[model samples]
Target chain A: MDKLLRDKKAIVIFVAPAFLLFTFVLFIPICQSVYYSFCNYDALTKPEFIGLGNYKQLFTIDRTMKIAFKNSMFFLIFSVVTQLIAGLILAALLTNIKKGRDFFKNVYYLPCVLSSAALGLLWMFIFTPKLGINQVLAQFGIKGPLWLMDTKGYIILPMWVIASVSLWQYVGQSMMLYMAQISGISSSLYEASYIDGCTKAKAFRYITLPLIRPMVATAMSLNAIGSLKFFDLIFNMTEGGPNHMTDVLATHLYQQGFKYFKYGYASAIGTVLLVLCLIVTFIINKFVKVDNYEM
Target chain B: MTDYIKADGWIDTFNGGEGAFSQQTYDGKIYAVPLNIAAACVFYNTEMFETAGITTMPTDWQGLLDACEKLQAAGYTPLTISAGTAWCLSMLAGYLCDSEGVDLAALDAGTASWLDSNVVNATNKMVEISKYFQETAAGDTNDVATANFYNEEAAMLIQGSWAIAQINGANPDFENKCGVFAFPGTDGRVIAKSDSLAMSATTKNPDAVIAFMKYFTDDTAQKYTAEVGGKIPVTTVEYDASKAPAQLAYVMDVFGSAKSTFGFYNESMASTEAGSTFDDAMVAIYLGTPVEEGLQTVEDFYKNNVWNK
Candidate 1:
């Protein structure tokens, strides 16, 4: 293996298939999207060069695009914060427990096994106006706001509902990741900290946190990207209604491309989303500073 | 279609009849066969109406609201609308537009504004009728709204003749208890559309495809469509009216006596983008967006996307 790796041609031959697959699957589509974003095409007519016309309209004129951008940012912030915090807490609890740790972990992981479509339908039922949360609230003399249909709560509540549902479904994966990272920490560190007049909280803050910085970076990047591309749940639920209130960039792109057949405009939205995700990941890595501490 | 003409596989079977096939003909060459002709109107449960002591279907918009109020007061959910599906809500708004005499063609031609009095009045009328919809109407899917009517929780559904098969599939006995009426209008016009099948121009086996198309227009298929499917037949074949479902007969009567006819708003529009904008505008009206603002959204979309093109 070392001899083969020493030869540059042999190395290229070994990696060529995967590299070609990646280029065809990811690079080609992204290049096509970038090209389409600059043209005015509707899939039926020949594409005409418009020179940033789609982007200008999307940023300056489209009200739904503004709403979608705002909503996507909200989901990104909340999903990253909630999932990371909840995962850490659950991982800590699982590690400190005396028994039934695997059972609890498996139970938390069950939702991740289900498809997002099934989870979306389940959450839709739970948020249904008459029969789900509202029904429970009625018995306590409290009228719940129309969970999915409430327009007044548009800016905050609906996005949070979606964020929390995503959190519920994927937090287990985060927890397991944290658990794996935490388990790798030596028992001697906690013992030394205890002898140095430190409590469990202090040990967690100074020892456990620094050691797991790399894992935190990984989790944040994954969750941020996932939240940015969120679609199916929102699509099956309100479909960006009560009149585009819950609209996100992904759903808006879908409507523009599939429903309206505005391929150029939709590609513009997709390009913006791709750039936004890359910027977000870069910012998160800078904030986390994954290389600051040793493993 | 030109390719099929070149290949000698295309046929002009209808000979310029004024129904579905003729609607699709271009320069005296037919390219498709229509499966059924359906209309958008009101479908009500007979048992619910009898219990509510309603004797006659309304003939105008105001009278329809009066009937809805009575049904609501009679301990029944008055209507079930699928606001979750934008087009379902737009169907009622489209009929209301007809009653108010808003010419969509003129609007498309840029001679009319969507914020005109008639168009605004039509939007307001949809808001008026929305009060009688089920409490969960805005959240209900098409399937759920249909279920609400089938479960006897709602007295009426503002849907098309296509719903008859769905109702029967839900409860086979509903075929006998269901009744149909024309959508109320200012002068009594109704909206109509055809569900048709189009053939590909380049085909490997034209004979088999032609046979399938022929089966759809034959006597047995036409009668079966009228009798079992509760749809209007486009063919000249005859079927027993008494043997046909009552709701189908009522729809036929409404279609025959309609003062005039217009195509469905979504279908007759110049582009799907314009149609979807109109649908979203109607949904906004239901969600408390001002009538003028909602209509203006569509007008702006039409100007920018359709007219500019």
Candidate 2:
């Protein structure tokens, strides 16, 4: 078996199917998008090469694209940070619990199983100014700001509200990742620490944190990429609105390509997003390398 | 392929008001069939109006406000709008622009600026109307707004005549209880657009598709549009006016008596980019951006992105 696995012909045969699948699924569409980004095409007419014109116009005249970039960055940073921290805390707590672990796990992960669109609508209803949170607030003689309709506090309030909803929906996912990593740790290490009079908090900081660093990096990278391309929840909830204040790059690309029939311009935005995701993931990979920790 | 299709006698012969028909044409070849001449207007609940004591339909801007006030006084939300879909809000802005006489042709010719005082006045009026909308309107989607009207929670919906069928579909009896009216303006002007059917230039069965297109505009289909869909029929086919849906008759009457009518502002524009800019600009005004500055965004969009392309 070892000799067969080491053969060059066997290696090619094993890798070919996945390689072909990736080429057609991801590589081909990306290549097409890159080609379209340089042309002026509206789907009804033949593409005319405009060469950097779409990018120039997007950066200069398209105001919403700028706002989209800002909003995408906010979601990537704020939502990722909150989800990671909350997931870590929850996972740590769940690990130490003696009973009802599966019950709590199922409860926490319930939202993750629901569709993003459904979760978005639920949050939208919860935030509705007329009959949702505001009505509840009014009963206590308190005035609540409009959650989805807000424009003045739009850049701050609605963004965080959406981020929190996203956090609620996906913290279970990160928690599961953290739990898997935490479970793989040898129990003997913790016993040794206990013998040396190490506290649980101290053990976590010195041992668990270092050992799980690779998993954290993986979780962060995955969450960051997902948030960067965030569309469905935001599209269903706010639709990048109250004056385009909540637009992420994905929604902006859709508006340009589908709504406005500017295929070339949308392609340019898509290319930028794809490039940005690749660079960020690469940086995360370079920095967060896993090694066996020696205490 | 072109020779084969042309040999099969597939030529578009649809003709209507230039604005209504031109959307489906390109380079002097008719690419589509004009199905219905539709207009944007306010659909109101008749029972709600009587409860609010609005006896006569408004024909001017001030009277519309008075109706809204009465409706509000009667403890009903006066208007249900979907700001979540920005174009619904823009319909109001477009009507105001029509009232202000912002010549779209002149705007296209680069002879008029969106920042003109008349356009500013129109934007201000839109802001005034925004106050009467439901408190949750800014967060509502088109479906939600329709549900508000269907459930009798709101008195009015500002939408195209196409919403008539939607209303009927939601509640079969809503057709009799509902009423339609043109947007009140200084000169009784209204804005219109159309639903059209277009054929693909390359087709496997050009003859079959062309036959269906013709059948789609035949007398029976035209009358169904008027009687059932509440849409205005394009062809000159006489149907019993009394048998038409009450809302349909009212819409036909409004179009008949209108002092002027313009094509929908967004559809009349050269490109969808300009159309979307107008929608976003209206949203800006509704969000309390100064009227002039809001119009300025459209002006910038038009001058920089749309015009001279």
The candidate scoring highest on DockQ is 1
Q: Candidate 1 at residue B22, lDDT?
A: 52
Go through the candidates in order and give each one's DockQ: 0.61, 0.58
User: Which candidate number would show the highest TM-score if scored against the true structure?
Assistant: 1
lDDT at B51, model 2: 96
Error of 2 at B101 (Å): 0.7
Ten-residue stretch with the least lDDT total in model 1 chain A? A148-157
Tell me the TM-score of candidate 2's A chain.
0.94
Kindly list the per-residue Cα lDDT of model 1 for residues B1-309, writing each as its tens digit: 434433432243332244445556668776767777787878898899988888998887778888898898899998999887888998888888888888988988888888899999888889989999998887777888888887788999988887877888788877778888888754768777777777776788877886787788777988898888888888767888776777788898988887766777876677886787788788878977788888888888777766777
How much is the lDDT of residue B190 in candidate 2?
A: 70
Residue-level lDDT tens digits of model 1 in A14-132: 89999999999999999998999999989999888899999999998787899999999998988899999999999989988969999999998889888888888889888886568
Mark the regions of model 1 whose C-alpha exceeds 4 Å error after superposition: A136-142, A154-156, A291-295, B1-18, B22-31, B240-243
lDDT of 2 at A240: 80
Name the lDDT value of residue B198 in candidate 1.
Answer: 79
